[model samples]
Target: MDSEFENQCLEQEENEEYEETESSSVQEKNNDGETTKQLSPREVNTIFNSETEVCEYYRQYGLQNGSGIMIRNTRKIDGVNTYLTVACHRYGEPNQKVVDSLKPKPVVKTNCKARVCAKRMDEDNKWHVTQFDNKHDHDLSPSKAHRFRCNRKLTKHAKRSLNLYDEAGIPMNKSYNALVVEHGGHKNMPFSKKDCENYMREIRKLRLAKGDAVALQNYFNKAQSIDSHFYYSIDLDDENRIKNLFWADARCRATYKEFGDVVAFDTTYLTNKYDMPFAPFVGVNHHGQSILLGCGLVSNEDTITFVWLFRTWLTCMFGNPPNAIITDQDRAMQNAIEQVFPKARHRWCLWHIMKKIPEKLKGYKEYDSIKFQLQNVVYDSIDIDTFEIGWSSMISKFNLENNDWLNGLYEGRHRWIPCFVKDCFWAGMSTTQRSESMNAFFDGYVNAKTSLREFVEKYDNALKDKVEKEVNADTRSLSTTIPCVTPHAMEKQFQENYTNDKFKEFQKEIVNVKYCECMMLQSDEAIFNYQVEEIQYVGDSQTLRTVKYNVVFIKDMELEYEVKCECRLFEFRGIICRHIIKVLLFKQNVFTISSKYILKRWRKNVKRCHSRTKVTYSTWKDTEEKRMYEMVCDAFYRIVDLAAENLERCNHLVGTFKKLELEWDTNDKGCSTSIVTKPEYFVKILMVNVA
Candidate 1:
């Protein structure tokens, strides 16, 4: 038994010695074998898919091969996700080994003529097939020449190569000139008789002066005023006997005799030259349209000058004692208006009043609170007594003053309200905006050099054309389905802007309302005969603290298509007012904004102007496509340079981006080439025996 046990132990010892020897040999073999190369997943994918390494691929490489370079298993080291992968290349045989391990992929060829196709020859050299593109047309046509011979022609790359030259300054190797050149000339069109006279005056100046360049420059400067960009005119006084001569006649009348006596006046500033200003005045008419009474050139916007100009215009045009007047919140202008038309109502413009509330209530912070209340005052939906209470509270909170320029009406409560005027139909027409449109239309005609005579001529022509269109439109409306609101209904809507007592006063005086298209009705003899108060009483009390206006509702004129006013609010918005709404309420089809009121006169003769010109090669032909491609490619390189500069500005941004994979791809054959789409594939042909 003792002998058998000893033999078993010896056998076990022998087996243990053999196993250790085998294990050591295996370890030695592993150490001797090629160092196991580690590669990034991105590098593996690149070699697996294709041979070419793009910007996205190069971005993946680590500095050296067989090193412990960290490979990103996922985009996020923490929380955020990245749309692209980033990796780095490892160098030497280990990287080569990684490349070798990847499955073989066939190299894809770019069939673009813009780039040469080359293949890897061993490691460093590249092999190319010269003139490979010329082997076949690849199309059904015998050649590219036959295919591009239609209306828009093109040359094949082979043909282009034959004509090429090497020039650095000329951009492309082969220069392509435009097929035709446009004329470098201009012509003057027919002008109105007054405009012709102006032109003749300029020509006379040019002919009379034979001087040095400086003198000639001065003469040309004066002569250039003949070019009126916007106005067209014909002279009745001319030898040619042109019937219509246009002149700047900014004059209108406001004959309001009803509801005691009242006249509202306002003025606004306009920019003619980029920085130069012009002031134009407006006189509110009972019709709700502001009458463009006059315009004057002022060096500065101040009260005394405007007041003098306005009083002179009123005396010359309408001649009278306006029992009450309304002006903008300008203290100087208001003071002057009061001095001139002492008998007039002398109220501040409601439009200007509303605009000033925001300035007065500076600490309120909430703009909507002020805007909503003022809108109610203008529209006349909210009760004036209630408005007073609300306004007083806001004024008290803000510590605003009644006499402050921004709160003009707070000192003149009842007089300035729309309901206080007999001409309630014209109540909402406050802003100088409506009259300003005419000036805007004519601003294109005048300039710094414009004389009063030239301005007058341009202004008259525009107004005459406008008035004539309005007159002609009446006939068309009668035939159309558009309706005109009865005058009674118009008065009713105008009443909405006023208080209950004011509406009662308007009803008491206005026996009947008339709806006449185009022509002003002479039937309302009472409107002219209504008593006017010559003596004016200046109220010591302040105006209402807070006034509210609203946009009552909008109505369409089905027949005439001319918007009518009910509250007379249209004049403020430059559309039909609420007075027109009264017209709509009584008769649904009273007025509509049809072709008559909205038709534009200037757009009529466009086709005639177009037909007079002839078509030619200069109008149609352009440069060759290859030249365009070269220009576009150069522009792209410039864009890339700019992008690089922009990136340099934000190094911190670059650091942020470095945390994620942002592989910029710019390896496509068309990266800098203008030929974007691929050409048709040409099947390789091997000569075969014919059947």
Candidate 2:
């Protein structure tokens, strides 16, 4: 019966298409190939195979005649539709009281007596039109007929395409435009951009029908069940609604133990549907890759919220706080960091501070010169004395001693200035760019329309991709080797120890050895001082520039050799500068880089504990196969443990396993090999043998 109904519907659609084509061809021939006449309703004698055909026919008729059709009445007998009455949208009279309340507002009803009535025949099970009226007392608008709700409809295929677009973060207008092009033009499209938006809104409503908070909690619960190491905390308001949320997976927590010395925290991204700020604690791994340590969603950016998020994340990491942290210059964030991480060095992102130069100093008469001098004083100064002198000189020259912004910047200079913060290890980072880059990584998986539930799911997918990338890097580091560019033993030592990324950075400094000239300046008992001049290119012009750096070498019998450069690159970023390399290799004749200089965090062979944890985005079948394989392995482990207790028992067990393997091979050749294709099939065989 269902097949027959579908076949009739298809046939009816084909016939309607043919009639529409014939009518258009007739109009082209009659009116100089322009201006088609509106279609009229079917006569009272017309018959339909089913009641569905009657309603669809009149709906299309109304669309062609620039009228809206609606079902006015329906009669059923024995739980089956027997009679139907369809009418024009303006068939009823407007109520006087309602009309008066909405005075001057145009009413759609005009008491037009246009309708069609159909009755089902008891013998043939067909519908016959008993009454039809084509006359109307209202004006018609054929050009705007498609605007009617009854005339516009989206196919299942189109709805699916729109859903894909929405998931991929494409705008509704762009999705609609793409469909318009696919259909040849806007006029050929059955629905408008507004219709597409309405559909997407309905889709979001359906997705969040169970409430956002409940959906988020359910997702967190599922994640925890899959991985026992998954940690999550939610802060609720008095109404029991989630106000803040934080989560860190097993891998993230494990990674924090290795590279948690310098963390970049930022909250500039707020693209979710709830308007909550997305705060990601980002760190740099051995490969110089940005790794997520933890993430949070907060309803407010106040100190209390930040403190709560920080304490929660810290507890997840077993109360091990980072040695140093980087963030934007937010007063609330500073206060929170002081309270939660009192001993950790807090530095503001230099990029964020320097980015405000144009806004804060643009009003000066010599804005361009002032900006240049300010940047020079902030970046080029090598020590506190030099920075202070340059800052004072610049302020005096610009007559900006009274400037409040400059004074404020100077007061907080230690938080952002490079020279002031160079004593701590930063893992080659000085800004919140790591956190921003992490946010950019999520763009492909989420967007502003993403809900809390969707965000969590997509976040997992993104993190899984990140872990795969890290694994690929680890594989490359283990399998491949980059040849040293120089003949220096230190270069080769670094190449052999560091990952490809860090090796490249070391190579940059080592390769610059030729551009540096070292001269021994002074020497004291077991101490040597040297001045190194380096040739460099500056700005877009690539003009040759010469910069001189001081290097001091101390030879200690107990602690090996120690070399320090005034550039402070090694102290700040853990990368040995060219000056130190020149002073050691060229003058002091130190043949190899000391073990102290080779940071373990950048080593290639260190086995990270996080690599053992499985990511949470595997397919269901893969997960099941893995689980079954582990169970089988565990069973064999027990058998092997008992067998290994005595030599005689081990020998007997080995002999029996060899015999069983031969029997299984013989059975495989006799029966179909497909039977043993799945892990469960092999597990069943093992279970039978054990029983």
Alpha-carbon TM-score of each model against the true structure: 0.34, 0.73
* Residue-by-residue lDDT tens digits, candidate 1, 1-691: 9999999987876553332111211222222486544322231212222223322222222211111111222233246322122222111122222344468544322221211122223343332212111111111111111111111223243223222321111212122321111112111111122332344346334433553223323332433343221112222223432222211231232122221133444435344332324444444332233334444444344666655555555554446555455565667776666677665555556555665656756555665665566554444433456557666765665455553653656556554555444233334344435434444645544555443333343344444444444334333323332222335454444343332333333443233232221222222312211111111122255333322223222334432333433233333222343333333433344432233322121112112221222222111112355665555445534444444556443453344334321221231432533223211110000001000
Candidate 2 per-residue lDDT, tens place, 1-691, comes to: 9999999988876554333322422342322466665545576768899888988888877776678888988999889998999999888887455535646667778888889999998888899999998777876665566777788898765886786676555667889989999988877788878888898878776655677677667667777887888899989888878799999888999999989999999887665778888888989989989899989999998999999999999999999999999988899999999999999999988877777888999898999999988887887787899999999999999899899988988999999889899988899985736645776788777777677866775677778778988999999988999998888889999999999998999999999889999999999878999999999887789989788889999998775888899889998889899899988887887889889899998999988888887776423213454566566667777767766778877776677678656866876867656644555565555444443
In model 2, state the lDDT of residue 343.
99
Off by over 4 Å in 1: 1-265, 271-291, 299-307, 321-325, 356-364, 377-383, 397-408, 414-454, 477-691
Clashes of 1: 83
* Candidate 2, residue 383: how far the Cα is off, in Å: 0.6
**lDDT score at residue 662, model 2, on the 0-100 scale:** 80
All-Cα superposition RMSD per candidate: 26.9, 14.5
Q: Candidate 2: where is the Cα deviation over 4 Å? A: 1-68, 73-84, 88-114, 118-130, 134-165, 170-195, 271-273, 432-439, 442-450, 457-465, 468-472, 475-483, 541-545, 617-691
lDDT to native, each model: 0.35, 0.82
Clash count in backbone of candidate 2: 0
